[model samples]
Target: MSSPVKVYVYDLSKGLAGQVSLQLTGKQIDGVWHTSVVAFGKEIFYGPGICETEPGRSHHGSPLRIVDMGETHMDEQTFVEYLSQIKEHYTADKYHLLDFNCNSFTNDCLGFLTGGSLPPYIKDLPSDFLSTPFGAALRPTIDAMFRGRASTGVLTPPPDISATADSSNPASASSLLQAVAAGATSNNSEMPSSSRNYLPTPAPTSPPTPVQSNSLTTPVHIATNPSSFHNVLHTHRAVVAFFTSATCGPCRMIEPVFEDLAKSKSRANDVAFVKIDLGVGMSNAVGGEYGVRVTPTFILFLDGNKTHEMKGINAPELRTQVDLLLYQAFPPHRHTTLSLPAIEAIPLNAILSSQVPNLDIVLAKVTGFIDAAPSWSGSTTKEATKQILAKNIIPYLKARGSSSPPNTSFEPWKDATISLVTNLSAGELFPVADMWRVALLEPAVCSWSATKFGPGSPILVLLSKAEGAPRNYSLTFLRMISNAFANKIVARELLLSSRSSITALMVAALFHDDATVRLAAANLAFNMTMHLQRLRVEKVRGNVEGDDVGENEEWDIEMTSALLEVIEREKANEEIVHRLTASLALSIRLSPSIEQLASLLEVLQAQKILKDKLERGGCGDTGVVKKEARKLIEEVAEKLCS
Candidate 1:
């Protein structure tokens, strides 16, 4: 059952009704009114007043009306706390006439307590009256007179029970209402003789219990002997042992509270609450073991190790300690629910159509070193730059050997394009990394992948005219860039800061129908995942990025999903198996949900891709993929599930 609410309305301007009509409203009116909320059984009255200490004194001598704003979910303590918050914010010094007056206060309390607002006729009265021209004209006089009175006398309420009532534990509703009525009928000119002497002793209480372990409902294990005590300690991960004596008065008072808490369903499985009465023939040696020098002592254990001990008849503290220990033993799993930004594709066609430089001449000049360039090697700056601009790089073919440039020529821009990409991969130039990504990379890849190869553009010329060689080179180029990002923090930072567009491009390529393209994209995705995993772990260890580049763990989940999608689609592609396995293995750090875990395991098992390779002791490369896959399988089985 819930407590009921009431609204007390008072006509503050009744005495000056005639003076207000002649000065402002220009017509006879009932009276100016104020309202307050009193929740039945809550033992508190909430009202707003100018420069006032408590409720009754501000609305003194005013005609009163009470309105019922039915049942509330708040209890007596919660209700009192709610009033404390209101009083803290609506102190007399901060009171206002037009903006935040008493009526506004009542409305706030009513809305919270009952989910309903005061009647419009009463709530809108001040604002509607102030909007009138005559009322507006008299605003200064009204403000001056009211504020002067509020600061001097109107805001000064006499000593009410609220002043004496405990802010944490309010007086009973019957007592508060009696105070309200007494304050209302008494003369406002003088303080009541008995008002200051009405302080009531608050009932003893405690804060609400923290969430307990559900297994608390099970019968407590009795440690009648040393062997039984040892067994119980070894069995339970967290044990709350109560050391009480039969003759201790405080222990008697708290025994029921302890028993009731032990019977609650919220207690954890590995945590136990037990009472051992030393007066009931328990040995002194047992008490000495726990260092129990006084009656009503508690000792907590974690994995048979003594962790914390408490003395006295404090049930709340005991329950609190148990909750803390349980939390440490089995912390709640917290996976973020925030959504990742959608991966947007780059517009390649639009970029190609715009100002394209003559790359034919540029490529010719740069390719002069092709013969002298060493074979494509590692990520060394000299080798990578040398290979990218080598002369063997296919030139953008002109129309039918007509030696005429097309209307839209990206072929002439190939040298400059390769140069920019190479520099980006080498971690040389990347101003506004996200801008370069959103503006250049995303649109270019999206447009190029969607369009067919043709003479109209340089890159398209290779994709269309050349056989498998051109496509292979393009895929390899993309893979190299991905690898660079995987190895270099600078490159990774730029790509990630680019609003995940770079990731989007890689994900898009992963779905390519061509096996070579898919393999390259898979490698890139694997590298990106590894890089992100490192950054995430570093962050958890308190390594802050100097640039304050915010990390969104949700993006990792999104990328993981994309990778999983690829795995499911291309499970039979052995060429990508090693990369996919390694990627999935490292990605396990993201803490995927149970449903995701089920899907991932089902895919691995049904395909027999990971299990078979691990059993045969053969996984491509240094057996890293196999090792990671085995580890991931075990981890998923252990942590993500039961």
Candidate 2:
């Protein structure tokens, strides 16, 4: 470009760097010169005199002069305003300031300002003067935005760039309206459609030409709220947020709880359960940003940022975490794979109330699809729909609930089925602790038995262990309850002891012909060693503490004595088949003075599975260990007395 007209002026920093500052300060040349002046749009330039090069600079660092659109000197007010804008807004991580090097922007900005050129490494730059050392103008905003943060750190407030551009630049509206009305200018005649209405007419005297500014981008903010959030985390001192959603069943289940919590003066005051509408705030862009595939994601926020995010509603467990969180003044909301808490690692109650963590947030996922199939021959689409209907979990549940089958019929997955039947005897299922724990601790059920007579899918849902049970009857038999919630049994009470109240339950648990029922009972026997040891310890402990050692109480010492007395009392013809219990009693007596654990170990050593079981229990490997121990302890105690 030819050297326009040489003009000297003070460099003013404003508008995206030195951008538009010159336009604001410069006066337009009217009449003949209007096209020339406005053609460059309204120019804004700021920076220093680069007429002199530093130690070793090239053409990119060529010397530059100054100019004021109307005068030879800058106005003090304009100068100050320009300085303030850049200090507050200008930022770039590439500008990390080093001790040896200058500040993040200084050296390069000065190079651009004086050279009237860019640094060889710099790409198309923002207002060149924004970084200039002219008055350290951008410092204040820079400090405020960064504020004691790491040099590489960045978290900026929402921008107003787009808004400002729409208001000030006429081209923004004209282009938008034109695009909106493309191929159909038919509507423009009706409405002026004014984006230009926001801006004050910038001195009508200026001509039709537009100013060029590829460097500046007005600040802008995203327009919508979020939909489903996987883990919208946050922290707070008090009840800071609420998590509610449009489709949460448990969120529905516990709506009463949240309301109750809200009503309780202390708890309500302590914390608030916020509702999050995942359905409304969902879109592919934001959905993918935060893993929010499920409804009713509760995200706790203390101030403005996130503290905790959860989906679904398990009242008991949520109460546990929220209660603790309030006491400790921390965030305890957690994410889980499903709505259910990890029944194994954590309390089953909490997982139930916890939100379901889903990263896939598409409607297609919720209403899953199947490929066109030959079996679905009728109008293929309708057939697919029928297939899906048949496969739905809801219908299966409804069908199971309608008949109300006997516990014996569902004995294969008895542990889980009982839990579901008991906990959710009503319409819904809330895996509460008392119920959830027992289901997990129950032994393996018979898979074949369940498959044959069990309400397959429905039983599986209520009794998570049902699927893990063995379904063998003829020759093949399987046993391994590897499912999650099977530990609740050990965590709760049982019906095996001579309490007449559980006699019916024992009959059902033991004699049921279904293989699932039998397998579950066998599974219960795995806790044999621990039961026997605990009984022995209780006997010794009661002797030392002089505590009430009643026959009815469920403890090691008491149960052992009771079992033996019962054996002698009944004097039945049946003989015990599982005999290691006798050997264990002798081992314990041979060394009563030894550590209580030593006696237990001797009995365990007598059986390989028992030893392996004890080893596993020591490492916290399985729920069966406790049950196994309980059984073994009882057996040994009975044998000693015999």
Candidate 3:
């Protein structure tokens, strides 16, 4: 059975915040919200590290509001194990009032449990508070009050709480489970004290197990056998193995340094640091295999082959070699060698529109169109289409705009939309296209549509039909394409497998006689460029999995060609020019092969076209968009073309 999750919202300031917030921050605030996730009969929160209690039994007393956070299909044991893995990241020392606090913890837990997040008003309060002058002035004071109060050891539950079976296994569960059994059994009215303490030692029969891969920050892997030693080297791209013995004083001295390195670097899956004790069972044979004659021997392995070795306890050398090993294992992107400051500063965040249109009016218009059409007269298809729109699509779109709506089955909607678009005339498609334009803003809907339909999705088909249709149909179609960038999955499809068709549509729309259609096309172009740029940034950070570099390069070249073609034709609209230039700048800057792109720019004489645009300003020349465009264009020219 799926467990129902809820967010318990407490007022940290009691009643004082609501009364004084307007005077202090120049804004009327309701309450100082502190949220906690209630799941599996326990109330889990973070403050002085991850803490727990019975629902509504925390020191904050009853919640002012309890937001229903849907349900989690995750099993209890797996969820407990997940918490243990993230416990170190939420330690008491890491907590901050305006930063990593209770709300942040609950937000993360809710997302993990149900793929949802806390409401914007609750999660965004800290930034809203900090944006004010008085709040900014009070930051240091707030920091001083909460700082230096970190618990010295593992956080323990309050005294009234009894340990659960899951709590006994600290290796597999975090302190969040400490009160589950007590909360389940107790009926006391008195709340437990919200104090931080150390957990009592477990029974001797239940010996603490070594930390596993789940907790990479605590990196002490005791390799007792050769297979275990080789396994670490095999799994990780780079391995730093420290051979140590109990008798060596130098080994004891440098062990802490090795651990610190492991804590810093081991979080990435491709690197590992293992400490092999020669004195432990079967560890001596593993040491002998590597020809280790003395204690404090370090060996560096890359791709399961020993590459470098060091003797004695030299912390500086060990640090230097480890850095070199990682540098060699994952080489930096070639773009890092460039001197393009302006391009490097470009924000890669995707431009997504979240505005929800008046759904009632949209539904009325859609149903009205269907009811009035002679094509729908005396047919069950008319009623079925309205039912799907009113019952399934409209409610889903409304709920999805505000919260993580349940994953309602979209197969019916998908089949119905495809069928309608395939059969409907271009003049009759605006209502359906407009509804989809709004629905595509929701990432789940966008992703589902892309996956269900592949290259021949209804949206793409609508775009094809709307090419020469009326302004309303064409504008709505372009807007729908622009909103597809809000979801990465569909955005990637538009950039990759569906690139040729989308490129043709965008190129044709860019030269449209209608300025609004051209502007919409430009906005679509910018959104696609931004998505590709984001992937490039992620690739540089080593966070992106798979081959984003090749895909980005391919899209950059093709998008540059398309943008350059339209730039010469766009004469009057500074808005279209601005978007086109911005998209071009993003595509050209910090590219994997800047030299190749510069060569392309040279071939196309992009410098002259951009310079000519600057010399002969737009028709209504406010010069703001033109000036920003020039700054970005000049940066590109100086860095790439010059």
Candidate 4:
């Protein structure tokens, strides 16, 4: 059943404020009241500037008027999730008094909720007020107060893992630990609380070994000495150490508590849990660092800094303090979260890897026919175009494969040859079998690379020349080949068999200054990368494998690095973001080393690509691309941290 959604609007300037506004601008205007969506009696509000969304609170006081937007097919939870996405993109930082403000937020919500926007008068009020000379002079004061109120009225909620990219709440240490612990051992089953009642197990005679817990929980490392504890702290981004003496009765009471905390939900946060024995005979140096002088002491370190410490016999207090400290250390933000869906790997079958029968003869016949054509005759040219388009030549090419097509011999028939390749690519079912055969004969033609084809590839050669029909045609032909890569079989052949040289050439083309060319290249790159990534994912899952499938199937870093370089070099290029997003996503999936991931993040941060996601007003495919890219980046960061 459809649910009722209402937009509650409050007019702050309805009284004296409206009078003042009228006197200043010769127009009667009410001060702005915050807007929120209410469903099932619960109000959903977003604070001014880019802030996290919370239920049951409004930065702006009570609404003066509530307008019903009618029924929505979406349920309450789904609707709120949608609002969260909007909040991630439409940040408070981008709020402008005359442009984007609270009213804009309301309008967007209304549009999404009811397929309509607020009244035009209300939506245009701020801009209209700013247009007058008197209002223009007062703009500075108005904007300052507006921004101040937005900032001051915001009420930050406790850390929620679902917080959007702009969440600023500081999570408690325990929360952070729980998050980290959850992330680390998510694959394993949880160890029962009853099983954790035992005393600390003595260290082995040899070096410390990882304890294989039956439950899926973060590993609890035992530090025999202070130095070992220090090493554990250095290894994890967040660490919680349980310092206890074996003889202490209170330490025994809370031993199970520490173990339970370690096994808390989601083991993906990557936090480390350590147990250090500070018994009578143990080293005191580590305890001295944390100033731990009491038995059953707990110290929390975030990013190598001692953030919190507590000592007590009460298990609740111990659990509370740890939770507060860990949350503060790793305040979870949705912006950096990544969703990596496992793609089942596909094993190579005979049709995919086996050589096409008689392809060499077919390629030889097509090249020979093109080479024998008389370029000087218009009638001959017309006939050649007809034959090429009619599929008369395709049969021979499919029937017999050639070692090498006469690339140079077809200098006079360049246009006709390009047309033939373009037409073949445009077919409904991409003739992967024939296309692969043709690609093997002229690898350069597969990527439409000018350098490899030289004068023989007329379209590509003309692309580097002055802007004219040639450049346009070059983009057209490139688009066709790129489209061919969208086909599963074709993509597999290029990525696995030909070894990705074609993919590299396509990526290199993104460096071009032309917006159209760059967009086409990006689209092409998106298709190829997605196809290759899917195959890679399948390989990872053991769902797909072939004779040539390498054991370690990683993303093409050369292509990825090239894409990153392009993203870095072309930060200002409006058309490059989509392509950059795809390339970076593909690179992230390829599982680059830690250093490589860090480098990619640094470039993204420096270029403000991730930061720019907070800005409003991306439309159509560009918006969709940005959204996907943002998700991929979050996943990349998550994987790197994990």
Q: Largest lDDT belongs to which candidate?
A: 3
Error of 1 at 593 (Å): 1.1
Whole-model lDDT values for every prediction: 0.44, 0.28, 0.64, 0.46
For candidate 1, give the lDDT of residue 32: 52
lDDT of 3 by residue, 1-642 (tens): 899999998665455555444433433456656678899988887654567788887756788899998998989876677666556555555554454556656756775677676675664354345444544554554444334333332222222212222121232122221222122211112237642211111111111111000000123343544655665566679999999876899998998899778745553347767777776545687899999999899999999999999999899999999989988897776556677666666566655555678999888987776777666422338778788888888888878746567557777776667656655677778878877888887655764565543445766667668656777877777788788876665775566556777767777889889898899888888888787777666655644222343354665677787788788677788778777877887776556767677788889988877665665453244433545566766766565555
Q: Write the per-residue lDDT of candidate 4 for residues 117-178, one digit (tens) a residue.
A: 44544543443444334444544543453354346422122123223111121132124323
Question: Lowest summed-lDDT stretch of 10 residues in model 1?
Answer: 208-217
User: How much RMSD separates candidate 2 from the native structure?
Assistant: 29.1
TM-score for each predicted model, relative to the true structure? 0.28, 0.18, 0.55, 0.30
Query: Distance (Å) between predicted and true CA of 194, model 1?
Result: 32
| Model 2 regions more than 4 Å off | 1-490, 493-504, 507-520, 528-576, 579-639
lDDT of 2 by residue, 193-279 (tens): 221111111121111111111121111111112311211122113542344444456667766666455333122112334343333
Candidate 4: Cα lDDT at 230: 58
What's the C-alpha lDDT at position 234 in model 4?
58
Angstrom error of the Cα, residue 303, model 2: value is 52
Clashing pairs in 3: none
Candidate with best TM-score: 3
lDDT of 4: 0.46
